[model samples]
Target: MDIRPIRTDRLSDKIVNQMIQMMREGNLKSGDKLPNEGMLAEQFGVSRGILREALTQLQAQGYIRRKPKDGTYIQDDIQSMLMNDSVNELLKKTTYSDLLDFRETLELKMVEKVIERASDEEIEEIIEGLGVADNEKVQHDMDHYFHYKLAQASKNIFFMNFIDTYYDLITEIAVKSNRDQVRRNQIAEEHLAIAKAISARDKEAAKNAVLHHMKMVDKTVIGEEGK
Candidate 1:
């Protein structure tokens, strides 16, 4: 706990790393209020300027948020991952086929993590997300949200951000390449099953559910393009 006397040169970065460590160690979980700036400055034995600078970086990284009078707290949602400059390069080179393939990879992984840590309330949101099936357009949007929320529940901000930025193209390709109503229904069912397994906290079952869903996407959706 005594992380003092580290050095003066890297004070800001060291403080940032310390806070990130707190988050990783479950000391500062999401929604947890950070120690007040004055308190943190006292604890870290750093100047207030150094502490504020570290907090600024954390806020920009989406690791925490600042409220007007409530002070800083951990963020509930992930930040956008499209900040990497290479995203533009990837987009320029990416085809519809590539987008479909990428989605299969991302969603499957997201589902696997959701199975590991999602709570009952989170699972219920996902289950309700699947019930938006009255209309095709609405169903598709719901399906996208379902996947996005599942990723968010994984506690992996990078994955959530990546999907949010690119999911539109993914849905466009899915709708165009696989117009079969039965197949759409199957996808919906798979999402529900994944949520069920996560709610049950059966890790292996959750993994299997996600992998099975990805296989379906591979066979029916991505398979249509022959890539």
Candidate 2:
């Protein structure tokens, strides 16, 4: 059977994606002023009205800001707001297994990035900063804390923020299903292996460490098949 036409982006969303692309590519930097509406509309090949709609959404999402006369400029500190409320809400709809898969991938990439980009001092910092989240603190998650510090070491905001967004769900699960002291000790050692591997700049070891940790999580939380 032939497939029907795929759903395409709404015109305004297409425009919005282009601008966000520009920002991602460094063509548009935070605190940089934008061209006037007429010129921007011409550049985007869209009606001024449609461009305005896209801009309105960006402004609401913390991507841009307006002034009485200075027109629009990129937000001065945009990185922290990269994962806005809308994306966070969408992330909420994912299943626990889906989240486990995502977490495994994100942490592995973070380890790789940390190995590649972090300074020696940064590596040491990461090694020392493996925070022990006291399970007694119902609000804290030991697992999330360890991985988040690794994310920071990776020096990639997008990855770091995704891990940060993941914290609430991890904490919720931890609170609902308390592990025994034996499991906690095992995970803590797994985390230590990850940090040691990262400090040694041994990518394969780091990958193995992360995989083992995820496997333990998968078995206990989502079962062997992650179903």
Candidate 3:
């Protein structure tokens, strides 16, 4: 247990990163109890409050679980935590176009899986979800819900979590891009195209629809940024 001292700005974040690194390197294993807060604070050369903040973050992110009347322990599901953290960090650094590109990749793959794995009922559920956004008025929440249902139709846990993690960020970009009725209608129509293609079981068409939609999103977001 060679926990290094953290003497940097954002001390809590540094501590969190070091703990994650330790877990990755097998220096920390699942079910291993964390050293007492006082000892950890002393080892890291940080105040107890800072170390507590880092522990709080770790608990929130599912990297560790804190038990009342007990100690903090490493969570068993380390991979999911790592994936979530990685996705969040990547999104923070991404520009509009970068996010659009990453989204396009994930969405295209997701729809393909949906086409392969979704039940007829699941497909209909997706179409029904799209109907929520079918109105002439643009509802950001409805739009986000439709895409989230689309991700669910993929029947992949990882895809579902990935979408869940980024949904808010995606919605923010959409809010910036959807400046008027025309753009909103265009986005609605794009979702309709994707739903229709998937319902018809046309994988190629679904892929094309998603690609077109992503390009439109990219253009809209970039255009908004230029303003």
Candidate 4:
């Protein structure tokens, strides 16, 4: 059998992963103080230096906070903003085609939730600012308004973050494509109609609007060269 010794240099990352696993298992929780370095090093079968390095990394990442007088405790708000930092990095490898696929597949959930759960007042907030979509001065600004606010109105923080994460690319495509004013006008009207459908709580209209919008978006910029 082939065998190799474990590399000590990677222990710090391993410690972080182990602790994160414990957190996920609920054995550790928000605002709970971590053990002293020596004890933690012993528990993880590592030296104190490795444990300290892991703790420092966690503190830097906003997963924990160190109090000079007290000790290190899990950050109180970690649950709400679970960014999944490593997982999100995979977005770096994503293509515009992949982005279009995400819109085509996942955004239906967003519309459905907004229709079922959002208040009339919350829905009104997004559509109100959309103004005349073809208005040359504010049209670009209004593009993000409808989608971003509607994501917020979905009442799902995870969905909101997902949309927020990819939204920059969405805007990038729009900015590049809308250099042609006619295309810009069409996009503005489409987004306005879609937002209004959601505001009216018309599920069929909202879905058709979203799919139609994506069809236009797919046909616009973002060629294979850009990917």
Candidate 5:
């Protein structure tokens, strides 16, 4: 009810963030209908076109569902919506090489941070995460869990959010590259090595481990593409 007027250069982004925050704070509940474009735009002191653009972005991000002749409603399963949308958007915009490069950059920094910041218990938790992929029934879910745990071990909220946001894309690439049993086993081994390096608080070793793992992933994905 306390919607403030927007005056920033990035009006649409600000609007989207404000709406998302409102939803998070329970001011807007699931199934609640958003005000019509004109009314809401007026309330925000923005042009209707800007409001529409923000609404479209929100819809794309799965925050709201727009129906024909009806209002936009909050999504019931916000987390799923976000994950699916994030992956879909990444898939639309990036190539395999791009994804790999971004992931390598993120993970290398993440491991270094973990070595510098993570507690003993957090390191143990990261090691425990590797157990997920050690099973005979190793799956993409396990890979996602392991990487997520590693990112969390970095003790940086920004790193955690970046990993969590693009996790589906990361897991998709892992699943594709891991179809071969040999590659799967190699990946599991790499995860364990990375976990151990982090546990030892060896920043250089951890960085090396991550870089090697990413190289293997890149090779696997590209080799598969060629085949």
Candidate 6:
């Protein structure tokens, strides 16, 4: 159980996610008896009640089992729990507009970071990434990796992590059913301009390029939402 006080409002969710991680790491197995309520509360630095609440949620979610006289045990069908929870969470909190907004902010900030730490090697990576995007058989994962590589070139840990986390959301949107070909072409062109700006060490140009890229995506998303 090894619960801890939640630092954020997503504490219960964090507890569940950590437990799932433990299972994935092989630290916990099906039918494993998790630490009892008292010990679990101590481990998480939270009170008994919060720990119980988290455990109850897990049980209802089919991630665990609890017995009156016995202890809590991991569920046998953990994958189903994981799949359902992940999909529901993604659907509940995410929308096309959300992805657009995220890409708009993250891409522009990534440009600022890239300009601040631009180097020959970094510029080369960005050029390679752009080449990948130009391919006819380009896949979402390929595009995601391309952007991730460009973010890595920025040599800023914060920028890299931010892009890695949010880039998938952009890839999801880009691959969605409603994706417009005309807007996609516009965005691709913006990517080319951004790469050129980075290659030339033009910070302002790179920032403006990303801003324009996002503006186009924003407009497309809004237009689609209206329909």
* Alpha carbon lDDT at 192, candidate 4: 78
Task: Please provide, for model 5 over 1-227, each residue's C-alpha lDDT reduced to its tens digit, 9 standing for 90 to 100.
Answer: 99989875589998998988787677888788889889999999999999999999999877899998988889888755555555666655887788788888989889988888889998887776664343333656677778878778777766666666565555555566667777667777898999998888888988899999889878987876676
Model 3 TM-score, 2 decimals: 0.79
Full candidate order by TM-score, most accurate first? 3, 4, 2, 5, 1, 6
Off by over 4 Å in 4: 1-32, 37-57, 76-83, 131-141, 169-174, 223-227
* Candidate 3 residue 58 C-alpha distance from true site, Å: 3.4
Model 5: worst 10 consecutive residues (lDDT sum):
131-140
| Ranking of all predicted structures according to lDDT, beginning with the best and ending with the worst | 3, 5, 2, 4, 1, 6
lDDT of 3 by residue, 127-210 (tens): 776543333235676677777888888877777776666666666656656657777778778999999999998999999999
The candidate that achieves the highest lDDT relative to the unseen native structure: 3
lDDT of 2 by residue, 29-114 (tens): 88999999999999889999999999999998779999977799999876545536546777789877888899898888889999
Relative to the true structure, candidate 1 reaches a TM of: 0.55
Better by lDDT, candidate 6 or 2: 2
What's the C-alpha lDDT at position 96 in model 3? 65
Q: What are the Cα lDDT values of the candidates? A: 0.73, 0.78, 0.81, 0.75, 0.79, 0.69
Candidate 5 Cα errors over 4 Å, as ranges:
1-92, 132-137, 170-173
The 10 consecutive residues of candidate 3 with the worst lDDT sum are: 130-139
- Each prediction's TM-score against the native? 0.55, 0.62, 0.79, 0.71, 0.60, 0.52
Q: How does residue 208 of candidate 3 score in lDDT? A: 99
- In angstroms, the error of model 4 at 21 is 7.2
Candidate 1 runs further than 4 Å off: 1-82, 95-102, 132-135, 223-227
What is the per-residue lDDT of model 6 for residues 175-227, given as tens digits with 9 covering 90 to 100? Answer: 55224455446656777888888778787898888788668657755664575
Error (Å) of candidate 3 at residue 71 is 3.6
lDDT of 5 at 200: 85
Residue 53 of model 5: what lDDT? Answer: 94
1 versus 6: better lDDT goes to: 1
Most TM-score-accurate candidate = 3
